[model samples]
Target: MKIVLIGGSTSSMTVAARLRRLHADWEIIVYQKESYVSFGACGLPYYLGKHFDDYQRMLVRSIEDFAKANIQIKPSTKVTKIDPNKKTIYFETSDGQQNTDTYDQLFIGVGAEPVMPKIPGIEAPNVFPFTRLEDAFGLKKLLPKVKKVSIIGSGFIGLETVEALGNLGYEISLIEAQPRLMARVFDQEMTELIDEELSLKNIRVFNNDSLVEIVTDDQGQAIKLKLASGQEVETDAVIMAIGIRPATHFLKNTDLEMINNGALVVDRRGSTNLKDIWSCGDCATSLNRVTGKNDYLALATVARKFAKVVANNMSGLKTQYAGQLQTAIIKVFDLECARTGLSEAEAKAYGYDFKSLIIKDKDRTDYVKHQKPLTLKVIMDKKSQTLIGAQIVGYNSAILRIDALIPLIWSRTKVDNELEQLDLPYAPPFSRPVDIINIALSKLAASLEEG
Candidate 1:
């Protein structure tokens, strides 16, 4: 059996690795548009910040490694079109050489692309949409000569880039069209805390203002930005991290089912509507475990899990993905934040009668030196009395406790006296008298009873 995978993203590589292990005799081929494959895109900001000198450290595996397993790795090859009915794919090489290849099974993991908004002077040489490794490399080369940088959008990538570049001693101006930073991920209260952290770091943030135009110099380099709020600021360069949309335009007009943003719709088994065709990654829709609906979460975690499921199903081992909670974690300056499941707005939109409570407390006992504050917010279904969502923000490893709460939310565990008495470990250096999660659950229970 001949299998072909498009795009050398985390999901594509994962599917290839697992499939090769399961079916060694089958022919496997991967077409990658970039020169490098299996590199962690998430580490781009850190690498650009000089946290790691060697770019090779970001690569999980090399082309030679995949080739050793008998998988054909075609780097710098772009798959322009796929004919599902004919079971053939047409691609163009870097040299403009076009070719056709047939496959018994095809996996499309083209991933997502950064949203490039239409604004005057957006094509400036100094303006870049921070997405690919090449973008990071280019930014690193430019940062030495650049004094100030403005970042558009305040999502994970935007925030990370701000911190990364800020650490390098560059003046940063973070512009977000929304009223708050990370509006989609964190609640208003949590965002307030993040806003404070950013302010402390001297990162100028402009919110509720959209970029109306990009002012560039004669050299076609972004120099300033005109905001819709009648504000203008001089900037040395601009990084656009507005958002991403699924990179599935090539599959347009095909019978394959897709979401509004072109993310391929697939079942729990990672099988698309078309037979012998599977897709997983940022390019495909994922099942949101909490909502029991398909969602397009452009996260590496979802892509990796779906990759294995697709590989197993193709190897005759029936398997199912357990969906996702949109779980995500981010580090902004010194504050670490994590959230799982839905936010308050999402819960309300889903028509769930839910109650949420935010608790502020010390992460550890006062006896511990340098103890920091932590915040925990828990959302529980009013009818079911179970956790539907949770968000945590704090310093040190306090935010990581979200790991323990994930199971409660995933299992839909009911909030009760027994759950409140969960035997979480406690230490002066670690936690307070009662774990923050337990305390938050206890508060949630109390609120539920009063209602």
Candidate 2:
């Protein structure tokens, strides 16, 4: 058997690794647009922060490593087109050359591209988008001369980049078109906490301020960012981190069902509408178990899980993607934030009769030194008392706890049942009189009774 995986991402590498393990005799080939494979793209920010050196360290597997497994790694090769009927792909190699390769089965994991707006002076040298190793290199080359860096979005990439560069003596200004920072995934109360943390780091943030245009200054080098609020500021450079759309342009000619931002539509087994061709990861559609609707959740954690399902099904094994809880976590300075399942706005939009409670609890008992306040909230259906979503923002709460709530939302666990049966460790140093999460949720359950 011969398998070809296109556009190397974490998911693609995972599928390749698993396939090689299961069928060692089979021919496995991976085509990547860049020399890097299995790159932890999320680490790009930290790389710039001087937290680590050595670009090769960012790669999970080298070309030599894959070769040892008999998986042919073709670096700097771009798959331009896919012919599902013919089971062939037209590709371009490093020398600007084109070739054709046939495969018995194919998997596409092209990942995504940073969203860029149609603004003037975008082609200028100073403006960039942080989505690849190339962006990291660009930022490094420009870092020494960076006295001030203006970021255009306040989302994950933007915030990470801001904090990464701020420590390097660069005057950072983060501008957000939304009224609140990280407002899309975070609530206003949580956003305020993030804003306060950023302030402590001496990073300036502008909210509800839209970038109108980018124009070159009189010197013809630096770009001036103009805002819709009739404001303008000169910036040494700009990194656009507004959002990302799936990098599925190559599959446009294919008859695949794509609706949510052109993410490839696939059923439980990762098989697309077309036969024999499969897709997963950031490039494919992600189903939200709570919404019962398809969405695009571009995260490394989900991609890894999806890859396993695709690998098994490709080998004639039955598997399913029960969908995701959209769990996410972020760090800004010393603060940690996490969320699982849906948000209040999402529940209301889904037409669920829901009620939510936001509560504050001490991280530890009064006698505990360095006790800090933590916020926890959960949204649930009033009638069923089922947990639909949960969020937490605090110090040392171990944001991984958010995953513990995923089953509650995905399985529609009753709030009372989970509260009583959930196995939880009791420790004074780690938590208050009652676990912070439990204390807040228990109060939420009580609120339902009064109504």
Candidate 3:
């Protein structure tokens, strides 16, 4: 059997590698639009911050290595069309040559593209989008020459780029259309902590403002950003870190099922509405474990896990993926923030009556050293008495303790007296007699009992 994959991203490469090991005899081919494949796009910020010098280190695998496994990788190629009836795919080669290929099964993992906001003079030379490897190379070349940069949007990439460029002595102006930073992922209280950290690092924040236009100099380089609030902020360049939409524009006018945002909708096994065709990645939609419905949670963790499920089903193994809780973590200067499952807003929107407990305590014993203030928030469904979501903000090591609570939420474990007394490991050097998680659970349990 022949398997053809479109878009050689994390999901595509993972499926290819797994399939190669499972079915040595099956023919596999990958068509990638970019010159590089199997590279970590997430590491771009670190690369920009000089955390690492070599750009080649971002690569996970080389073409020559995959060739040894009999996987044909066609870089600089685009899959233009798909005819599910004939199981045929039409692609354009790097040399501008049209080609056709047949596949027993096809996987779509085209991923997403950075949002280009609608604003006048945005096409100026100094404005850039920090998404791909090529973008990283271009930014690296320009970073030393520029002193001031205005980043539009305060989401993950936007905030990360702020730290990366700020570390290099660049005066950063972080502009956000929302009133609070990272509104989608963090609550107001957590966002306040992030804002404080950014202030300490000399990053200027402009919230509740929209970029109406990009004012350019005579040389056609971005000079300043005109905001809707009647403010013109001077800058050397701009980074469009607003957001991203699925890169499945080529799949339009076809019968393939997709979400409103153009992300392909697939089942738990990674099967789309059409037979013999599947999709998984940022370009596709997966189930939200907490909501129990299809959601477009575009994280590298989700892409990696569901890719295996797609490979298994295509390899004749019956595999099913449970879904995702949208677990994510990030570091901003001295503060480390992470969250899993649902948020208070999400729980309420999903029509669940929930109670949330916020706790502030010390991470470790006084004599143990490195004792930092830790803040944890837990959301529980009042009716079910089960954990629905959790968020943490604290020191580098302290915030990562959210790992223990994530599994409980993922499993929808009930928060009762028994759970409050969970036998978690404890040592003065690592945690208090009652760990932070246990304290949060105990507090939550007490609230439930008070009813």
Candidate 4:
């Protein structure tokens, strides 16, 4: 058996490694468009701050290592087209050379691309979106001598970059078009915590400000920003952490049936609507198990999960994937923010009346000397009393606890069933008698009795 994987990021590398282990005789050829493979794109911010100076440390494995495992690795090579009907793909080598390859099984993990907003002077030099390792290297070379910086977007990457660079003593201002930073994930109260934290970090944040124009300096490097709010900010460098879309435009003219945002439509098992084609990672549509809808939730966990699903069915095994729960956690200073499932607003948008409870509790005993922790809210369906969503903003809070809640929501299990049995570990320095998750559920159980 021979397998051809078009992407070499987290999902494709994970699947290819396993398939090579399971069927050692199978010829597996992995094509990675970038020079690096299996590196943490999430660490781009830290890399910019010079936290890890060695660029070679970012890579997990080299092409020779994969060759040792009997897997053909093609780096700096792009898969130009996928013709499922013909069982072949048109590819482009890094140096502008063209080639074609045939495959028995194909997997695509092409991931997403950072959105470069259509604004005047956006094409100006030094205006950048640091999405890949190469982009990180390009941006890192400029940060050392920079004085002031303007950042667009206040999402995870935006805030993280703000803190990382700000800590390195750069005057930074972060701008977001929404009324609150990370508006899509957290509630109003949760956002307040982020605002306070960012303020303390000396990173100026501007909400409700949309980019109107990118101004350049005499040397043509981007230096000023004009916002929709009639505000002008001057800076030496402008970094765009705005939104992103799937990176499947290479298959644009092909027979792939994609959504409006260019995401290849895939089922829970990562199999596309097109025959003999499977896609995972940030490039494809991920099924929301709770909402029963096809939405794009580009998180690393789902990417690996979907890759396994494709690897399983291709190897002639009976397997099924339970779909995705968009769980995410972000760290800003000492504060931790995590969320999963659907929020209170999301449930109402689905036309379901839900109840949400806001809890303010100590992470540990008042005399225990453990720092204060706050769990913002727990949103649940009133009819079924199930855990629909939760947002936690706490100091030293357990981000993994929110991760544990994802499976509960995905299984459609009731909230009361998991109460008092979270089985979280107990260490005085970390947590108190009952974990915060259990405490919240216990509160919910008491509320049930009160009604």
Candidate 5:
């Protein structure tokens, strides 16, 4: 059996490694557009912030390693098209040479690319996109000489870039078109807390506004930003971290099933509409456990797990992906936030009869040093009495509590006296006798009983 994998993304590489181990005699090859394979793009912001001086650390596996494992990696090769009927793929190499290969099975994991808005003067030399490793290296080299940096968007990458640049003493101005940051993922209540944290860090925020144009100098350097609200802000450089779209343009003309945004649509077996073609990762949509719909969750956690399911199914294991809750966590300065399952707005949007509650408490005992204030929000389905969503915000390790709620939510565990009395460990240095989760669960159970 011959397998050809596209993109050298997390999903492609994971599937390649797993397939090699499962079938040692099978032929596996990976074609990557970039010069390196297994690059962890998630660490790009930390790389720009000088968290580590070695850029090579972002590479998960060296070419030599894959070669030793009997898996062939063709770097700097861009796949142009796939002929499902012929079972062939055409690609262009770095030297402008075209080639074709035949495969019994094909896996597409091209992942996503950063969205570049169509604005005037967007081609300025100082403007950069924050998705690729080259973007990190380019900005890291340029930012030392630049003082003020303007970031467009307030999503995960946008806020993370703000924290990274702010730590390096660069004045950061965050602009979001929505009324609040992370408007899509987090509710307004959670965003308000995030807003407070950004303010305390001295980061300037512009909400309910968007970039109209980049006012650049004669040298093609951005000097100021023209906003939709008739506001102009000066800046030495601009970083566009708005969001990403699936890199599936090359496969548009094919018969493969895709969502409106070009994300490949696959089933529990990670099999696409076309036979012998499988896809997973940011380039594909995964089943949302709570919503029971295919959702584009472009997180590495989803990509890696879904890859395993795809690989096993291809290896005759009949494995299926269990779906995901879109669990995520982020840190901004002294604040840490984590969330899993649906938000309150999401539950409402899905037409779920849910009750929600928020509680504020301390992370540890009063006698414990460095105790910080912790806040928790939980949403439960009234009909089933099951936990549907949870959010946590606080300093130190408070966000880790979300880990406990993830399994419960995944299993749709009902909120009852047994769950309220969950025997979570407690120590003065870590948590109180009754953790914040217990407190929140107890309150939720009481509310359900009263109703």
Candidate 6:
């Protein structure tokens, strides 16, 4: 069997490795546009913050390693088009040589590209987009000369960049077009905690405002930023962390089905609309376990799982993806936040009759040396009394509790007296006898009963 994979994203590499292990004699080839393969772009922010010196640490596997496994990797090769009907793919080599390859099965895991806003002076030399390895290297090289740094967007990447730069003692300002940080992911009450954390760290936040123009000097370097609210922020550098869209423009002319954002719509088996063609990773949509809808989940966790499912199904194992909760966690300064399943906004949008509550409690016993306040919010479907969503924000590993809630949401476990009595491990230094999860569950149970 001949299998061809596009892009070097985590999903593609995972499928390649798994397929090689499953069938040693099968021909496997990966065509990647970038020079490096299996690069973890998530670590770019931490790398820029001096968390690690060697950039090679970001690579999951080297080209030589894949070569040893009898898997061919064509680096700096751009896949221009895919003719599903002919079962052929057209591509350009590193030296600009056009070529074609026939494959029995093809996987498109091209991933996504950073969305660069069409604002004036966006092309300034001092402006960078935090998406790829080169962006991190460029910004890290210029960090010593940069003092005041402005970041546009407050999504995961943007806030993480703020934390990375703020840790280096750089004066940082965050700009978000939304009313609150991570507005799409968290509720207003949850975002208030993030707002407090940013203020405590002395980071300036410009909410409900967006960058209108990047004021640059004559040398084409960013000097300041003009906002839509007539606010001007003086900065030496700008990092555009605005989200990303699937990099599937090359497939626009193809007959494959895609979402509004260009992400290929795939089923639980990771099969695309066309036969023998599959897609996963940031380039495809996956099933939302809670909502039962195909959602564009660009999370690495989803990509890793989807890759395994796709490879297994292709290998005749008939595996199906178990769906995802969009589970995510992040830390900024002293604050750590984690969430899984649906948010209140998502639950409402999905037309679920859900009841939500937030409980503020202590993480540990009063005798503990460092007991911090923990806040947990849970959304429960009123009819079924099952947890549909959960969010946690606090210090001292409070976010870790989100893991316990994941199974509850994934299994659609009812939030009743039995769940309220869940046997979560507890000690004075770790947590109270009644963990915050239990407290939230207890409240949710009461709400369900009252209705």
Q: How well does candidate 2 match the true structure in TM-score terms?
A: 0.95
lDDT of 2 at 112: 89
lDDT of 6 by residue, 136-252 (tens): 888988989979999999988898889998998999999999989999878888899999999999999999999999988889899999999999999999999878999999999
Give the per-residue Cα lDDT of candidate 3 at 437. Answer: 89
Off by over 4 Å in 6: none
Note each model's CA RMSD in angstroms.
1.0, 1.8, 1.2, 2.1, 1.0, 1.0
Using Cα atoms with residue i matched to residue i, what is each candidate's TM-score against the true structure? 0.98, 0.95, 0.98, 0.93, 0.98, 0.98
Better of 3 and 5 by lDDT: 5
The residue-level lDDT of candidate 5 at 123 comes to: 91
lDDT of 3 by residue, 131-161 (tens): 8998888788887788999999988888888
Two-way lDDT contest, 1 vs 3, winner: 1
Better of 2 and 6 by TM-score: 6
**Mind giving the per-residue lDDT tens digits that candidate 4 earns over 1-451?**
7799987887888788878878989999988898767776788888887788887777777777888999898889998887888889888997899999999888888888899988887887677887888778778878776889889998888888888888889999899999999988788888899999989888888899999998887777787899998999998888899888898998998778799999988887778877777887888888887778888878888887877877887787756667766778888877889888887777778877677888776676666775686765887776787778877878765555676677668777776645647787777776677777787777776676676
All candidates' lDDT scores? 0.92, 0.84, 0.90, 0.82, 0.93, 0.92
Model 3, residue pairs in steric clash: none
Total colliding residue pairs, candidate 3: 0
- Winner on TM-score (1 vs 2): 1
Q: List where candidate 4 sits over 4 angstroms from the true fold.
A: 398-400, 417-428, 433-435, 449-451
Pick by lDDT: which candidate is best? 5
Off by over 4 Å in 1: none
lDDT of 6: 0.92
- Native RMSD of candidate 5 (Å): 1.0
Error of 4 at 451 (Å): 4.6
Q: What overall lDDT, based on C-alpha atoms, would model 4 receive against the true structure?
A: 0.82
